[model samples]
Target: MSNIIANQLDLFGAEEQSELFDEDAPTVYYHGDPDRVHARLHRLIAEARGAETLPWDQDSTRLYRKIVPQMVLWLPEEEAAQLRFEFEAELERMKAA
Candidate 1:
């Protein structure tokens, strides 16, 4: 597998991202042991909040753009949205520099 796909799979602990989330649910739910899923989601959100740089490659940037917003869903609704907005804003700022 390509490094991008490999990295995503490793991070999410899922064979496919789609397999990790249910589409029909009002609130997305991950398919896994609850403790593992909770810990992983919290960690992803923390990483996104703390990151000052985009990943060093285009593929990783693409993954970050896609995943971080979803990761924020673990937060309260307003805070989650704000973090997603802030994360994206930072990415744009970095790209423009």
Candidate 2:
């Protein structure tokens, strides 16, 4: 496994085996709610698709602040994998387009 995957497993624990997207923030604060987490993921993916450059600082921070907390709280494992798959697939699609 890649260092990133290994690190994630170590951080989140082995029982929670899941893949996180490369774009995920290294440190996340937990809040609550799974449906909201999914929504934020969808929004982030959409923004990333439309964006020409990486959104960092306030814009990125604001986006992630909403999503990451919920992700950390509710959907640590599956959400990570789902987001990773979606982000990578969307990246590929954009590249092709």
Quantify all predictions' global Cα lDDT against the true fold: 0.64, 0.65
The most accurate candidate by TM-score is 1
Instruction: Encode model 2's per-residue lDDT on 1-97: one tens digit a residue.
Output: 6988878867856455444544564878655666876776788788867865544466755665565544644677866777867766665565566
Stretches of model 1 off by over 4 angstroms after superposition:
1-55
After superposing candidate 2 on the true structure, give the runs of residues whose Cα lies further than 4 Å from its correct spot. 1-31, 58-73, 85-97
Q: In candidate 1, what residue range of length 10 has the lowest lDDT sum? A: 29-38
lDDT of 1 by residue, 44-82 (tens): 555555666654478877887787666666666776676
Query: What is the overall TM-score of model 1 with all chains considered together?
Result: 0.46
Superposition TM-score, candidate 2 onto the true structure: 0.39
Task: Give per-residue lDDT, candidate 2, residue 37.
Answer: 65
